[model samples]
Target chain A: MTAATADRVVAEARVCVAAVLDPELPMITIEDLGILRDVQVHDGRVQVTITPTYAGCPAMDAIRADIEEAVHRALPDHGVDVLTVLAPAWSTDDLTDAGRTKLAEAGIAPPGVSRLAGAGTSTTSRAAVALELSIRCPQCGSPDTRELSRFGSTACKALWVCRACSEPFDSFKNH
Target chain B: MRSTCEAVATEAEYAVALADDALVASQRLVEWVARAPQIEEDVAIGNIALDLLGQARLLYQYAGSLTDPPRTEDDLAYFRDERAFRNVCLVERENGDFAVTMVRLLVLAAYQRELYDRLARSVDPTLAAIAAKAVKEVAYHRDHARQWVLRLGDGTPESHRRTQTALEAEWPWVSELFDGGWLAPALVERGVAVAPASLEEPVLAFLREVLDEATLAEPDPRPAVTAGREGRHTEALGHLLTELQHLARSHPGASW
Candidate 1:
């Protein structure tokens, strides 16, 4: 295949493979969860880089297997390289803008960690910043809430309850 | 004196040092999920344990990589006898109360940050790589523990009293961590490990600062109950292992 064609194939493969839904959150793909990072084809080898949303996230093994299966189905005859990169660390910022929007729509609050603010501010403003974000209960749109736990169905999310509607909800905690 | 081989031993020793702490502590922390004094701390400690488990997996896997027989991480963790494990005694101690548990975590996480930070720059590529990744998570662990220490230390009459008692209960065990032996001298010389003694001054200073912030008295260094470094642990370890290993031992190869 030509160089241009290979590049197109790599890009197309990422879009297709990333579209696979996460088993837990069927509405969101592993890519939308900000787990899938880079997909490329070089020297006829398909290379894909992924990052885990949390340490010990059990879904990682499944996600890696799923990615391999999906990529193979999309582009056969190409050697696949699945690289799990842990450096430069994965952040909620890496979540696609569209991914964040989808999270809000799905009643799981999108992670509100903003890198646009200075790093110093991020550290100093942790509690204040957390409180500032109106994590309206996905169930009732009420900001009257209390955190139940720093963890939820997964390590990346927190268990919270809305006092107004007496609804227990999950908030995607910013790491 | 133990031979240098026994000191640093094989790569498995280093792996055991890391894995025991994570595995034992993770086991301790999970007990708090429904039982914590407050729900926030329950979730926080549980999350902390999860992160530690992740680190244990990497460390044990690396240890497995170095062994001739090639044991899996699970084998080293689940099958090891008490004497074979090398985590500090402090981590294995039961989570007494919210205050005691938080204090234990604060002390351990502080030491872990320094160890992982230094290890990140080690000559061993695998250790250095794992340390580099783990340091970030442990940093959060330290911060979370520190924040709680401050809140409980300063919060109320009851909180302040409990926090002080917890500090005293766990303070003696802290000395064992820095009472260096076998692994320390060799790994320090090779730049593969930070000498445990080197951590004393900085770790104490950090601990003191947190204690002061929390309005708690710094516990005087009492006699050391040293054993874990040389694989001597307290009675608490057996109980911990019994609970942690039950499912794995009873139903080997079982997966939910």
Candidate 2:
């Protein structure tokens, strides 16, 4: 196939792979979560790269399988390969606005801005500075929420309880 | 790759050593899943264990790529013998109590934070990337340990005593972490790895501050004679590996 045809095929494959929902958080697609790193088609083969939100996220295998299945359904004749890249690491800052909205709608507080954004922001300094931002309860929209635990149902979230609605919720932790 | 075959071998060994530390520590932490003092702690410790396990998998994958035949992460993690494992004795030591686990985590996380910070600037792109990601994760791990250490050391008489004892027991193993064996110096010179000894000053300084704030005394600096970098692990590692590798060995290439 010509270069233009290959590019179109890769673009179509990207759409298919991007629509795959995150197994752990069914509300958001992998693309919305910023885990779908890249999609390329070369020599009639499709290559999709993804990065895990957490190192040992068990959802990765399912996501990989889902990506393969999606690409195979879209381009049946093309071989599909999923690659996991660890470099430049994944940050919650990569999450799309749509992803944050979807998470909020699903009663999960979206992640706050990543404190590790700038260069030379040492861990010591970051630890010394406490996060004081108010997180509104997703269920009740109450700003009066207390952290029950720094870790919650998943590695990426923290457990919080709202005083207004007295409902327990998960807040996506900002790495 | 510009790296010579010998250099690749050395880098692979270094990666294995780092991976082993994370893998062993993750296994120990996994024991706390349902056994922690509080339900919150169970999730907390499990999250930390998963983070460490993730780091181990990434390092193992990188190491495998360096091999001639190119082993997978599973091959390095499950197939290797105890004698071939290169994690430090600190991580391999049995988890005695909650206080012991917290103290061990405090020291290891502090050391890893320093190690990874420098490693983020490695000449090797892959190692640099892994370290860059790890630095952030370990920073949180260190903070978690520090918070627990402060709370346990200053909360009650029993907690204080237990935390202190745990610190002392784990103190001897700290020296082995800084003992740079054969591959370290060469890797350091090549801008691929940090000199373990150079991390001692900063790691201790940070620990001392944390201990002071916790109202805990620092144990006397008596380094262990056994060097884990040279593959001289305590008896505990073999047992830990047996439990870790058993399922994988029992059903080779098994996956859910």
| lDDT per model vs. reference | 0.77, 0.87
Q: Which candidate has the highest TM-score of all?
A: 2
* TM-score of candidate 2 against the unseen true structure: 0.94
RMSD values, in order shown: 4.0, 3.2
| lDDT of prediction 2 | 0.87
Instruction: List where candidate 2 sits over 4 angstroms from the true fold.
Output: A2-4, A117-119, A122-132, B1-9
TM-scores for all candidates: the values are 0.83, 0.94
Candidate 1 Cα outliers beyond 4 Å, as residue runs: A1-12, A24-26, A40-47, A75-81, A112-149, A159-171, B184-186, B253-256
What local lDDT score does residue A130 receive in model 2, on the 0 to 100 scale? 29
lDDT for model 1 = 0.77
The residue pairs that clash in candidate 1, if any, are none
Candidate 2 residue A87 Cα shift, in angstroms, is 2.2
Give the candidate number with the greatest DockQ: 2
